[model samples]
Target: MDEIYECPQCNQKITVPSEIDRAAQLELAELVHMGRRIDAIAVIIAKYKLGLLDSKIMMAHITAQKDTCVRCGNKLLEDGVTNCASCSALNLNWQ
Candidate 1:
């Protein structure tokens, strides 16, 4: 019998023989959770070296917004005000 699985990298469905061990799959999951791009690539390389061609791709997504008072490093609200709510500084920039 073969077990069907979804590829997290390319969203492709594949089936592998049930005889394969589960420990290798768990190890791959751990590597994906590391959250470093280079580390993820290294894991892929190592898997390939061990004759494991069917590997997963990991991606780290981070979003950062810049909206704070220049004088004070405090975050600014929706309105573009020079003074921050916490600190009264006349240097707020929002974008």
Candidate 2:
């Protein structure tokens, strides 16, 4: 029977044979050395799941944002406060 594992990157579950754990482990190790820490952890976690090994993978999801200040940036969210957290300037332009 094929084992299913959850991808820590995109959160999509996948299936692979238990025997491929070693190869997967090697690939994940390379990713870590490349500074792709999150991706590496995801691959290792998936491989462990397929190998029927006990493992715990913790990952935090971060949403990307532009460099502009919160108020200067687009009106992404509506808050009752009038000042911007990033620049601490009055949001007079807010409408």
Candidate 3:
């Protein structure tokens, strides 16, 4: 069997390479280097709750770089975006 790494906090397999997941640590290397502190921490908490290695990866899978729609959970828009394609309708749910 492959050697596996499990998180002590939640007892889940650490699938994603720890190196790729800067969001989990929310690196405090510098003030400017900090990765979404709140969101990263949320990702840490949400990881166990959601059964994943990292919340950022989870969000990326679900929301794609956290680009989902605030109203309908859509992720078709460009980066640093807030609204989805159908912001007004807000009827079609993505989840």
The estimated TM-scores of all candidates read 0.28, 0.28, 0.22
Give candidate 1 misplaced runs (Cα > 4 Å): 6-11, 15-20, 36-54, 57-95
Of 2 and 3, the candidate ranking higher by TM-score: 2
Best by lDDT: 1
Off by over 4 Å in 2: 1-22, 50-95
Clashing pairs in 3: none
| Candidate 1 lDDT over residue span 1-95, tens digit each | 75444433335444343443455444433444444545544554565332234332121211012355433456766442234465554321322
Better of 1 and 2 by lDDT: 1
- lDDT-wise, the better of 1 and 3 is 1
- In angstroms, what RMSD does candidate 2 have relative to the true structure? 15.9
Assess candidate 1 and give its lDDT: 0.38
- Give the per-residue lDDT of model 3 (tens digit) for 1-95: 22234333234343333343344322311211334445543644545353434543333322322444433565555542122565421111122
**How accurate locally, in lDDT, is each candidate?**
0.38, 0.37, 0.35
- The true-versus-predicted C-alpha distance at residue 62 of model 1, in Å, is 19
TM-score of 3: 0.22
